[model samples]
Target: MASSEESFLARRIDAEAFPLAVVDVLALAAVLTIGVINHNGVEYLSTNTVGWLLTLVPFLVGWAVAGPLVGAYSAGAAESAKAAVPLAVRAWIPGSIIGFALRASPLFSGGFQWTFGVVVLLTGGVSLAVFRWLFFKLRG
Candidate 1:
């Protein structure tokens, strides 16, 4: 049994969390796009939007599933870089792994390679951590 105050607090947190989640999505898209361009070249993005989407969607789905589970988009998570960076990295590990699994699926054209997976794990974590830090720093 939740009180009216508790319900209102939950609603308020929900309002705040939605926008944060949207920004998280945007940040992830940017990071993933940069990775694509780095590996596949800018022409790949311009010439093959479907390929780009196929490459990108898995990771987005990964984060969409992982972020909330790991509290990456919570109000508390957004409160400071200290909180955000660790949570972002924690979320990113499982998220990127899920992306790799999705990439290996027949629905997407790409297959997972260990070297590429390692690169994604390392760079994606760093990118997300830096992004989270910057997000908090700039917001503050």
Candidate 2:
């Protein structure tokens, strides 16, 4: 059993973890914005709130899966960028592929290709880097 001091420390650690969760949500929002732009171009901003809504699920799933492995919730405790990058990539790759496929489908008619795919990949990668850097700066 843990003592009161230990419990307090544990709560403190948990409190520190909240920043990482915020980072993950921000990263997801960034990626979703990129996806919307790629799919509909600048015109997306002018019309259709539904497109934005459609992006929420994948963003949540991607963030939830990748955030823990990449230490997005643990601040400076990630093993290294080298360790975290691959995990972020792994989490986003499948979602990107699916996004591309859906974009290509007749149901939507927005052409998907390497360009948007690359954008999504870069967005995910850059998000990890930025979050990691912020974590170090803020906590380390």
Q: For this target, which candidate reaches the highest TM-score against the unseen true structure?
A: 1
lDDT for each candidate structure? 0.79, 0.59
lDDT of 1 by residue, 1-140 (tens): 99997764553343455656666777778877998898889999989889888888998899877877777766777567787788778988999989999989987877989998998888778877777677667777
Clashes of each: 0, 0
Alpha carbon RMSD to native, model 1: 3.8
Once fitted onto the true fold, the runs of candidate 1 whose alpha carbons sit more than 4 angstroms away are 1-14
lDDT of 2 by residue, 11-62 (tens): 3334455655576567767767776777678677668767675555544665
Q: Give me the displacement of residue 90 in model 2, in angstroms.
A: 5.2
Off by over 4 Å in 2: 1-16, 34-47, 69-112
